[model samples]
Target: MQQGSSAHAIVVLARGRARVERSLLSSDVLPLGYRGAGDMAGESALVGMESYTENVIAMEDCDVVRVPTSTATALLRDDPALMQALVSTVLQRQAEAEERLTSLLFRPVEGRVVEFLLQAMSRWGVPDARGTVISAPITHLEIAKAIGSTRETVTVTLGVLRREGLLATAGRKLIVVDRDALAMRK
Candidate 1:
């Protein structure tokens, strides 16, 4: 769902992950965060929103179950767990937004990119002898969206990061060469 159009249903991400974001008028993507399997999205409809608040782009192949707003609202009323889950999801999203805004105000593009990579590492990173490998597949454009930058800028910044020995890429994955050094980059 895009920013303005409400998806009048609850999206149960049953498989894979999705990038949650808002498409800016300038074509810059203000990414909120990610939604993984078992996470529920598009709950704004049940919360009295006129439309879906954010655009959810699949990070990979995904399978989803959509529950109509009316049904989901009824379930929300009868199911305390569901309500709690929704509240938690909303709160987490809010926190991510706040963090992004803070980064935008105080950090440069490189810092933002580094921070993004570090955060991703903590989320889906796999431990290996070389360093922590971010298992999730991400594209340069997605990185730009998350950091509110252009893809070309991201590409160049990544190159600089690599040259500095702070990061590396294998296949479609990003490997943090030195977590401590990379974290100190900002």
Candidate 2:
């Protein structure tokens, strides 16, 4: 969805798709193809772009609250809490993109799988007695797509994690067994 210059508009969609076309006019730093978060969206200087792009890319059948870019600017004008949320969201996306870039460039295939899992946990994980469980359901193919790997690779890597007790597959869900241990893989 397009935004106005002076007004902050929240774009809420029960179900739709958002393709982050371009941000050339909006920011000084021009962007390339859409990366999941920061790589394609940029930093906190462009928080609205990050939030809007992510919700468009990752979420499905979900509820989203859009704080109009203008409203967000005004709230940031006065309220520290809103400012922090905006900054954190942008930085978090940037961090996620950096981690993925590292995996894509330097890490091994297995390590990349772990990175994907950890990223998902950070975004949609729910704490449980065993560990943190992914709040949203995802498939091996989807994970493979996110990491630029094959579905077979994802399946094998997941099997290895299961053997090592890092995760457990319960029905269709992947439940994390040891978050700290998994995070320390790198």
Runs off by more than 4 Å, candidate 1: 2-6, 24-28
Show the colliding residue pairs in model 2: 8-68, 8-69, 8-70, 9-68, 9-69, 10-66
Per-residue alpha-carbon lDDT of model 2 for 1-186, expressed as tens digits?
Answer: 332232235443334222233344656322211222222221222344443332224334434455555655676789888668767866775786676687789988788888778867876678888788886667897677666778899899899889999999778888989988988875
The alpha-carbon lDDT assigned to residue 170 of candidate 2 equals: 73
What TM value does model 2 have? 0.62
TM-score of each: 0.86, 0.62
lDDT of model 1 at position 2: 68
Candidate 2, residue 33: the lDDT equals: 18
Judged by TM-score, which candidate is best?
1
Give the clash count for model 2. 6
What lDDT score belongs to each candidate, Candidate 1 first?
Answer: 0.88, 0.62
Clashes of 1: 2
